[model samples]
Target: MNSVMITGCSSGFGLETARFFFEKGWHVIATMRKPDNSLFPTSDRLSILELDVTDQNSIDRAVREAGPIDVLINNAGIGYMSPFENTSDEIVHKLFDTNTFGTFNMVRAVVPQMRGRKAGTIINLSSSTTLKPLTFMSTYTASKAAVTAYTECLALELAPLGIRTVLIIPGLSPSTSFGKNAGDKISKSGEPADEYKALMEKVQSEFQREMLVQELTKPEDVVNAIWQAVTDSNCPVCLPAGPDAVALSQ
Candidate 1:
């Protein structure tokens, strides 16, 4: 069985993707900031560990414990919704820390082991927003855009070592509570006060509507793409999880 290490398996795509691989007979190492009570049920093939992607020490420890991962899936991320101008410096930094630098640190931890074997695959999870700009999602879009760009460059850099780098872009996956949680996080942040509250709420509601109606890509869609990228000998550098994402990319 292939050995795989997947991050952010507390919920959403990360959780689903980890389950998918485990069911396919792969040994899966699933990491989350809080894993003791994971949403995913206990399984023989699945091992859950605590991992905060923003922390390099956590990344290092998890990578060391997982050992010789055949596939590394960088799926942990956070979202912030507010006007670009209203987005606080801390918020912007947190977004990049988890979505961009987190990915960088994880890849850094695993790539050397992959290089030693000259046989491994790295799959970066990105967003369709990288293709189509969205309002109030400037920081989120920028983070995923950075992931896509980094994946592209890494693909070229790692190609010579027989290790491959790939990206899977998922359109609005409504099955996850990402939007709801993100909105709640911002509202609870106490940043958008008095004058800006109405506008912020409007943008968030509109985004929720779009997610419900036009962008309901499920976790299955992303997991399937991940499987293809990890198992297929000739997966492309970038793969779209749904038709909407494919069209947007074009």
Candidate 2:
């Protein structure tokens, strides 16, 4: 039986992906910062584990407990939004800690085992914003952009080792908790600068308008793309998950 370990299985893409793989009969190691087995269906193939990607010890322990795995999904991440000048050092560090360094830690933990086995797949979740930068999202875009670039290089390096590295870039998904979580962070960061306040308002209005008219992608589409990344041996290093992403890629 093939086993897959996924991070951030508490909600959104991670939760849906966990359910998808579990239903498909793969041993699903669903991991989150806090493990709750009730969120997933009762299946012998599903095991929930607590993992904090920012903590190397936590990542190391989770990888050890997960045992041999056929796939690793680095899906745990946090998003932040604010004018670059308004973004604090603390917020900047926090964003990179979760979105960039966290991914690096997870990859470092699993690579040894995957390398030894000479067979495995690593799928990373990145944002479509990396294709076209958005105002007030420079920091978040940079973080995910780093993941995209890292996966590209890693794909070439790992291919010879029989390990596949795939990136799933999903477009804006308001259906997920990502928007709410990012909003919560922005709220905690206080208000925007007076100079940028008007610009921010205009950007937000335009963004909302575009969202209403645009064919936004769903979380399921992302999960499906991820499934393809896992099972398709010939899958490209970068798999854009939604119509918006596909459009941007072109």
Candidate 3:
């Protein structure tokens, strides 16, 4: 049975992708910051592991324990939403650490094994905001944009090695916890205060109305995109998930 190792399976896209692969009869190594058996059904084909993508040692240890994986999905990431000026330096570092360098660390840890075996698929989750800019999401967009660019370069570099690099650009997803998490992070950082408060509110309200007109991307849409990225050898280097993403791609 082909095995896949996924990071950030605690929730959101990572959790859904883990279940999707397991249902397809693939051995799944689901890595989260905190492993919770209750989150998924018990199966011999499923193994829950603890991993912190921002930590190189954690990534290396998880990859070593996973043995040889046919696929690696870099889905563990954090989001920040605030004016670039209001976004603290610490927030920038933290966001990049998880969303950008975290991906880099995971790739570094697993690519050696994939290279030795001469085959593998690596999928990185990015955001559609990278395609069409969004207000107050500059830092988050920049981080995901980095992932998109890195994956493109990686695909070219790994082509001769028989490895595939895919980037999944998903649109705004209300079903995911990402927005809530981002809001919480912004609150903790005390953003949108003083001069930026009114502008932030206006932008957020406008964005919400825009979302209503555009079809929101579902979890299933993302899952299907990921499946295509993994199984379809002819899939494009960048696969857009959901209507907004498709629109942005065009």
Candidate 4:
């Protein structure tokens, strides 16, 4: 069976994708910051690893133990939703470290082996927030946009070596860990400045109302997109993984 390594498999898209691939009889390495046996069913085809993308030691260790991988999915990332003015430099750096540089670090770890074999697939997870801007999501959008851009350039750089790079952009998924993480980040970043309070409240109200009608992306949308990108040699370099993202992509 072809082996696949995925980051952030503890929840959301990453977890769902891992399960999807496992169901297809692929050897799956589902990694998270903290490995939990209960997260996946017992099988020789499935293995769990601990990985913190921001830490080079962790990334290197996981990749080494994962052995030869046919595909590497950089699905590990953090989200922040706060007014730019209120977003601390520490938070900004944290976002980039995990969202942008984290992807870079993982690619660095896997590419040499892939290039040697002249085969592999790299699937990166990005947010639709990069396609359509939002009021309090500047930092989050910027971080994801960097990944989207990086993946596009990588598609060009790796194609000649027979390695495929795909970008998966999905829309707001309130039911996923992304939403819970965003809220957690907001708490860490603290409240916005008083001057922006009224505007922030209005934006939040509008967003809640919009959510009632919006066709939000589900984890399955991204899971299917990754499957196609891995199985279809002629798949597009960039794929929008949900209704909202598809509309934004156009």
Candidate 5:
């Protein structure tokens, strides 16, 4: 049976992907920052481990523990909300650390093993926002854009080695905690926003309308894309998941 490793498996796309792969007979190594704090229901084929993607030692340990993985799903990410002028260096760096740098660290840790096997796939969880930018989310959009560009480069570079890199761009999924968590994080950041509060709130509301109220997509949408990326022999290099994604791709 094929075995896969997915980061940020505690929730959202990561958790759904792990469960989907497990049900499909793939041994899934689900790595979260806190294994014990997993919110997803447990399973026998799912092996949970603590893996902070920003830390090299954590990546090394998880890589070693996962053994031979046929696919690596880099799904860990954090979000931020602020206008370009209001975003602090600290918040911007935090978003990059988890979304961009974390993804790079995971790729670096797994690429060597994939190279040895000469057969593996890397699926990056990118954002549909890369197609269109919204206000107050410049930093978050930029981070996903970075991932999209990096994955495009990796697809070509790793192809000769018999490895594939696929970009799984997800639109908005309402059944996930992504929006709630993002709102909470921004609320806690305590950024000074007297005039921008209305604008930020408007942006946040629109994000919710698209992602949650409309139910534009579900976790299963992403799981299906991920399955196709890892198992389908003729899958495209970049697959967008969800209805919004399909519309955007057009």
Candidate 6:
């Protein structure tokens, strides 16, 4: 059976995707920062491993343990929201470490095997906020925008090697850790500056309102998009997931 290794399987898209593929009879290597078998249904086809995508040693070890695989899903990322001025260098670095470099490092770890075998699929999860910049989310948007741009370029580079690179743009969803993490980051970063105060408050209000009123990108939408990316030769390189994401793409 074909095997797939996915990062960030603790929750949201990664977790659901892992479950979906395993139910489809694919060997699933579901990885999180800390392994917890209880989060998954018991199955001989499932392999849960601890992985911290920001660390090369952790990635190398996970890749080694995962062995050869037909698919790699780069879904491990963190979200933060703050005015650009309020976003410290350290916070920006952390964002890039987990949201950007983490993805790049994971690709580096798994690409060698995929390149040699000349077959594999690389699916990355990027945010739909990148399509339309948010008032207080410039930093977060930039990080995810980098992923979208990188995947587009990587697709062309990998096609000749018989490997496909696909980008999945997902909009806001309650199931993901984004809201919690972003709120935590902003709390730690302290409140917005006086100049940005009014704008930030208005943005936050609208954001909460949107959550209540808008149809978000569901975990299932992302899982289905990933399935098509891996199984359909004619699927687009960039597939937007959810109602908001699809609408933004067009």
Off by over 4 Å in 3: 179-187, 191-193
Pairs clashing in candidate 3? Answer: none
Write the residue-wise lDDT of candidate 4 on 1-250 in tens digits. Answer: 7999999898888999999999999999999887988989999999899998989999999999999999999998887678998888888888898899999999999999999999999999999998889999999899999999999999999999989999999888866766454443334767667989999899999988878889988888888889999999999999999889999999
Model 6 weakest lDDT span, ten residues long: 179-188
Model 6 RMSD vs true structure: 1.7
Off by over 4 Å in 4: 182-187
TM-score of 6: 0.95
| lDDT computed for candidate 3 | 0.89
Task: Please give each candidate's TM-score.
Answer: 0.90, 0.95, 0.95, 0.96, 0.91, 0.95
Task: For model 1, give the 10-residue run with minimal summed lDDT.
Answer: 181-190
Model 1 scores a TM of: 0.90
Between candidates 4 and 5, the one scoring higher on TM-score is 4
**At residue 225, what lDDT does model 4 achieve?**
88
Mark the regions of model 6 whose C-alpha exceeds 4 Å error after superposition: 179-187
Query: Superposing all C-alpha atoms, what RMSD in Å does each candidate have to the true structure?
Result: 2.5, 1.6, 1.7, 1.6, 2.4, 1.7
Question: Cα lDDT for residue 127, model 5?
Answer: 89
Pull out the clashing pairs in model 2.
none
Clash count in backbone of candidate 5: 0
Candidate 1 displacement at residue 58 in angstroms: 0.8
Candidate 3: tens digits of C-alpha lDDT, residues 40-84: 998889999999887788887888888889999999888777788
TM-score of candidate 4 relative to the true fold: 0.96
lDDT of 1 by residue, 31-107 (tens): 98878554656776778888888899898898888877889999988876667767777778888888899999999
Evaluated at residue 57, the lDDT of candidate 4 is 100
